[model samples]
Structures are given as C-alpha cells and as structure tokens.
Target chain A: EDQVTQSPEALRLQEGESSSLNCSYTVSGLRGLFWYRQDPGKGPEFLFTLYSAGEEKEKERLKATLTKKESFLHITAPKPEDSATYLCAVQAGAGANSKLTFGKGITLSVRP
Target chain B: EAGVTQFPSHSVIEKGQTVTLRCDPISGHDNLYWYRRVMGKEIKFLLHFVKESKQDESGMPNNRFLAERTGGTYSTLKVQPAELEDSGVYFCASSRSSNQPQHFGDGTRLSIL
Candidate 1:
C-alpha cells in the first residue's frame, strides 16, 4: 500500500521564523510528489511538484525539496498570511489509477 | 481562465437525507477529480472522470454515493441516506491532462446531523 506521512501535526512559529515540514512516503514507485497549501474552509492550492531526487522548486518565501524517500517544504521568514495546512501527496507510476495518496497535513500557525 | 467551481459552499442535513454537490471544471479541462477530507484526516480521492465517462471510481466510499458527468462539462455527486460520518469537506479539481497538475475549487463543507 502507498502511504504518505507528515510529521509535526501542528507547529507555532513567530514572525520571521523559518522551518521545514516533512513528508515521508512508501510507494511502489514514485511518479511525482506534490505540495499544496490549504486554508481553513478552502480547498488546497498547488505549490510544487517534484519528480526526482535532488530536485528543488521555489516560489516567493516557500521552497520544496525532494529526496529518495521523503520531501521537505521549507518556509523562510513566514508571515501570518502564510499560516495554513501544508499537504504532501505521492503518485505511483505503475498503478492503473493515478489517484494521489496524501498526508494528514501539517498545520502551521505563524504569529505576527 | 476560470478555475474549478463547486456549488453550495456548505450544506447541512440530517442523517438519511439526500444531498447533491455540483462541480464545474475549467474550460478545456479533460480530467475531473473528486476528493473529501474528513475531520482530522487527510484528503482522500473519491473518483475521477474523463469527459463524460468515469475513468475510475475505486475511492468511492459505497453504493450510497453516486457521481455523474453528463455532457462532459459539469458533474454532480449525490449522497443518499447520508450517514453522520459523511460530514466533511468535499473538493473538486480539474486538469487539462491526466498526468498534469490539477486546479482545485473552494470546496463544499457538508455537515450531517
């Protein structure tokens, strides 16, 4: 079974604090890893897609890096508006269904 | 272009009642997906539709849930005899291709009594 696990169920950070959210996965074969940001009462918004180990993508204050077994989403100098639940998901390449298996998400609270 | 849209931003109903959620995919998007997040849980896939045909429905919880994508433009998901466990946020997403990234809607929050 393909499973995705996220650590630090909840995190509180002060303004300008930097941290990383972890997403560990065990899949038959990873086709792609995805990162999404979800606010309360809203759906998830796409952030990045990592296809291979050593690959990294960045946007604004957020950066995403992928490894062979896990991925990290690093937030630099986060603000109150950046507070949201960060989700990680993995897709298996060999499956007839391309449905993604998602982590429970890390709830980030940035106090300003 | 407009993003995926879901109707009835929120719904409240009693157990055993029927509720229907609707989704409008982005123009030209061929792949539509349905997912839901139960309380304190991860988002789980419910189904996927390619045009007017269901590409996969393995994630569907049970026979009580029925989904349709008639005419290949809009889709609807109906839950009959809803259970208390069905209370959650239902999300709709669409992608131009099956392998590409998907765009999501604001989601509809369902509360069962």
Candidate 2:
C-alpha cells in the first residue's frame, strides 16, 4: 500500500524562525509529490509538485525539496499568515487509479 | 477564469437521509476528482472522472455512494441512506490534464445526526 507519513504533528515557531517539515513515503512508483497549504475551513491550495529526486521548488518564503524516500518543506522567516496545515501527498504511477495518498499533515503555528 | 466550485457549503442531516453534493469544474478541465476527510484522519480519494466517463472509482467506500459526471461539465455525488460514519468534509477538485496540479474548492462540511 502507498503511504505518506508526516512528522511533527504540531509545531510552534516564533517570527523569523526557520524550520522544515518532513514527509516520508513508500510507494510503488512515484509519479508526483505534491505540497499544499490548507487553512482551517478552506480547501488545500497547491504549492509545488516534485517529480524526481534532487528536484526543488519554491514560493515566496516556502521551499519544497524531494528525495528518493522523503520530501521536506522548508519555511524561511515564516509569518503569522503562513500558519496553516501543510499537507504532503504522493501519486503512484501504478495505473489510472493512481489518486493521491495524503499525509496526516503538519500543523504549523507561527507566532508573530 | 473561475476555479472549481461546489455547492452546499454546509449540510446537516439525520442518519439514513440522502445527500447530494454538486461540483462544477473549471471550464475545459477534463479531470475531476472527489475526496473526503474524516474528523482527524487524512484526506482520502473517493473517485475520479475523465470528462464524462468514470476513470476510477476504486477509492469509493461502498455501493451506497454514486457519482456521475454528465456532459463532461459538472459532477454529482449522491450518498443514499447516509450513515454517521460518512460525516466529513467532501472536497472537489479539477485539473486541466491528467498529470497537472488540481484546483480545489472550499469543501462542503457534512454532519450527520
């Protein structure tokens, strides 16, 4: 079974503090690794998609990097507005039914 | 251009009642998907549709759930005789292509009493 596990179920950070969230996975063939940010009552918003190992993508203050067995979401100088649940998902290239298997998510609380 | 849209932002119903959720994907998007998240569990995929055809319904929990995407524009998911275990947030997403990033909607929160 394809599985995604995210560590540090909850994290509290001070303003300007930098940290990284971990997401480990096990799948047959990884087609894509996705990163999303979800607010309390809203749907997840797409952040990045990593296809291969050693690939990295970044936004304003968030960066996502993928490896052979895990992925990391690095937060640089995070702000209060960046506080949300960060989700990690992986899609297997197994077949047409290759839907995403999401992690339980890491709840980030950035105190300003 | 509009992103994916779903109706009934919140729904509260009694057990055994049927509920139908609707989703209108962005114009020209061919891949539509349905997902659900229980209270404290991770979000799980329910089904997927490519245009008007059901590409994969393997994630569907049981036969009580029925999904249809007609005319390849809008989709509906109906749960008959709903149970308390089915209470959760139902999310709808759409992607222009198979391997593209999907756009999501502010899911509908379903509560069963």
Candidate No. with top TM-score:
2
For each candidate, give its TM-score against the true structure: 0.97, 0.98
DockQ category of candidate 2: high
For candidate 1, lDDT tens digit of each residue in B8-37?
A: 999999999999999999999988999999
Give me candidate 2's TM-score against the actual structure. Answer: 0.98
The stretch of ten residues in a row with the least summed lDDT in candidate 2 chain A is A91-100
Clashes of 2: 0
| lDDT tens digits, residue span A1-112, model 2 | 9999999999999999999999999999999999999999999999999999999999999999999999999999999999999999999976675588999999999999
Encode model 2's per-residue lDDT on B35-87: one tens digit a residue. Answer: 99999999999999999999998899999999999999999999999999999
Candidate 1 residue lDDT tens string, A7-85: 9999999999999999999988888999999998888899999999999999999999999999999999999999999
